[model samples]
Target: MRRLLALLVLLVLPLAGAHAQGDPPGVKGLFLLTDYPSQTVRAGEVTTIRVKVNNAGLVPEPLALSLQGVPAGWKADILGGGQPVAAVMAGVNQDVTVQIRVEVPKDAKPGSQNLVLNARGQIGQQASLPLTLTVGTETPAKLSLKSRLPSLRGTPRSAFEYTLTVGNDSGKDLTVALSAQGPANFQSTFTEGFGSNEISSIPIEAGQTKDIKLKVTPPRDVKAGDYPVLVKVAAEGATAEMRVTLQVSGQGKLALSTKDGRLSGEAEIGKASTYTLILNNDGTAPVEEVEMSGTVPANWKVEFNPKTIPSIAPNDKKEVQVAVTPADKAIAGDYVASFRANGRGEQASADFRITVTTSTLWGIVGVGVIAVALLVLLGAVARFGRR
Candidate 1:
């Protein structure tokens, strides 16, 4: 009877040990947090925290998850109702995704909000890795200014147009003010909503581009040269600027005229006759440093009224004189003289025709002898008739 009982006890002990191996008494698995991003989130943003309950035991068990330490405006949701998982098999892993939402007000100060997620199961209870929630005010929008028309090159009194490109690099919308500064004569105008010489607010969204036109007109009296103009763009907390060059040029008109097409006075050899040529500036611009030169007959001389005339303003005119003389031994039927005037990008010339006549002398002696002979003949005729 004793031998039979020992055999029965040994069999029962082996069976109990087999059941114990199937179901472990203490927690024998790792409940790890997975699927959750690096534990930090911005205010007003939502982040998902995931927990993976890994069971490395011989038996299955249930799992329960819960969240804690969330701020007032923040909230968290767990999968499986924070209840114990029905049965997590030994050496098997279970996954849980918890969503954390942060609702920070606009007035929320910049600081860190601490959050914790606790997952409990039959095997053990595991706390999730600490998550840091950063709350702060949104960043301001960024603004930039660009000029499409690089330079303006035109005569004074003429209007010039410039196009401007405005870019917004912020993550939000922005309204920018526009202005310009340069020479007093330089005038600028923008699109309808964007006025001239005032704060023009333009609404631009993040990563957006807009085009505007700026019409610049220099005063009529402005000199010919390069002038710099500044274009400014400003937003709530951002500002930008661009520079433009305004080039002014001179404007003028030139005309040429002659007193006579032909030169006709009869003169002896070695005598001279003069003719005139005129140049005028009809436009409202000055002509400076006049000069006259051209090929002409050797005996001809060309001269200007004022050898080096100063600047001739609008509606001003200047004259030049030319003189022609024949050589003493030359017989002159007709001669041509040509000349040209150069000043302020203008040129002109004239041709002159000269005639020379023979000198007077001898013939009076022959006429006196012929008259005496006629008188003698008449006297003889009268005497014969009386006899």
Candidate 2:
């Protein structure tokens, strides 16, 4: 009977020790905040605040947290803990997120406002996690236009290229429209987003930059001068403008000089003789308003199609055709003629040599006549001898 009683006392002693070590009365979990940005808020903007609560006691505990000291027009939301954060184990932490929205008036003064967030539970309470909110007006955006190559100067018919740099110095993204104006004959081709007369939109991110290529081609007839071109850039909130100058110059060109200035064709003295003269513009600029003049022998007549050409660019060549006809009374021989083309800078000339020969049909007729004469003479001699 004594052995049984001693065993009962051993078991009872262990149960009492376990009951004392389980959990203290009214002990709760520790509430910790995580995943929250620094304690600052933008006036009239919505911000999210997040935190985690941990049960640091030996047993599971339920937690309830509340927010305090928010602005009049602001509201706070407890997204994670509507049902009272329940069953958190000892030494383990639970996560909670709180979203706070602050609405500042349009005419709100520019200054700093104070705010506080509180966390509470059945056994413990933590108050006033300090946060600061600022209220101010935002500044407008500013945009600017700059050019990589500001001036274009070249000879007529030469290609002029430029690169423009568009910058957005504002705190927000901006869309800029671009346009350019220049002379009528001066052709300009901009990149896809740019246009000659129409404004095209180009999106530039905040504090970003972009490059646009502009190409210009002057007309061959454009004279040397300082022509002003306007480039305009406009945005929804801002506008910018720039100017470009185009200078044209005349350059002495190399030309082809014709040495052989004559042409010949076999004709029955009245047939036509065709002559070709080549005019080359070797100058750096194009040549326009070309006038051609040619002189032929008195016995021959001259006719040319398109006696004058409108224009010819540099390093370009044009041919002028001249038709000459000899008079019926003229003899078959060589003929000489000269031609000149008057252009913008200088004159080009060609000398032509022409040879006139008898027709093949006339030669055949002469041979036939000689053969008939020989036959006739032979026949007369034979008849005389026989007589």
Candidate 3:
């Protein structure tokens, strides 16, 4: 009984260890599986399917991939990591995914075709997966583009921003290029809706949509009118276009100068000298709320009679009087004085040349003192001669 019990123990131990390690006893297998084993495809279009290679308690090995029973006029290839691959490796109890891309010819008949995807290991393990494809009518690649705000109104200095949605209806992923058509000197750029960095193209997945932003900036000298812009998108064998409008409004162009276009003026120390300034509106829009300001030498005074003008019509000019005074200790020489005017977000500045001279009161006092001294000297000489 002891011998029998010992033998039974030995037999059970080996079997238990084998079962715990992996598959029990003689169970070893490799499998190829896909959720979509049977599907329909369109002629002249390419499609890919995912396949999984599972190693169930089989020794880790590399298997070569091949397709069997493929009909003529059909193209099939296995892909791994976006590259064509002929073999794949799966460790014991591990699973790996591979892609099988199929391209059907346009001239093929509309009927059912059967194909087999196979993976064979060097140690004599083989796995086969059967697939069915029903070739039907043509399915064309397509794209769509739409803008949320089709038209915008702003000045030439403003950037017109537009939000757009791009959709991919094709059966595959694609990289699409973006472009725009508009008048000369009009700048345009594309970016993601949530991002500020610019992009010329973007990748989109099948049956999905992406939001993008378009910013258009026109030249400062652009005329006020309605301008149209054409936005285009192109992808692999498909294209789309959209039209948008930019309503550019007129803006005020303010300029500052003297009547004779001279930038020089004269001012006396401790006294204000008046200057005539010409403020011209050269744009199509009216200038409003024009404010005058000046920069002069240290401790000097300056002021405008009319601190601010109400408005100036297009192609019109306004005359303003500005008084500038030099500092008391300023030497007699040339000095530069700058004056600026601002109106409706427009600014202009001009420089004036000023020369200083001493006042007449100081000279008169000096002459009087000299005459008094001369009279005293003459009286002294007469007295000395009499003594």
Q: Using Cα atoms with residue i matched to residue i, what is each candidate's TM-score against the true structure?
A: 0.38, 0.43, 0.63
Backbone clashes for every candidate come to 3, 12, 0
Q: Is candidate 1 or candidate 3 better by lDDT?
A: 3
**Candidate 2: what lDDT?**
0.65
Q: Candidate 3, residues 182-237: lDDT per residue as tens digits?
A: 99999999999899999999999888989999999999888889999999999977
lDDT of all the models against the reference?
0.62, 0.65, 0.88
Q: Model 2: per-residue lDDT, tens digit, 1-387? A: 999999999988854554455434464445554554344444555555555454433233444445555556665555544433323223332233444444555455667777655555455434346656666566567778788668878877678777788888865578878778888877766664354442256789878987776677777767678787787777776877788888878764535443263333344477886656667776666777888777777877877766888888767887777777777677778777776777766677656666777778878999999999999999999999897
Query: Top model by lDDT, which number?
Result: 3
| Alpha-carbon deviation at 270 in model 2, angstroms | 17
lDDT by residue (tens digit), candidate 1, 251-321: 66556566553434445566665656666776556777667664545654445554555666778777666
Position 381, candidate 1: lDDT: 83
Model number with the top TM-score? 3
Q: How does candidate 1 fare on TM-score?
A: 0.38
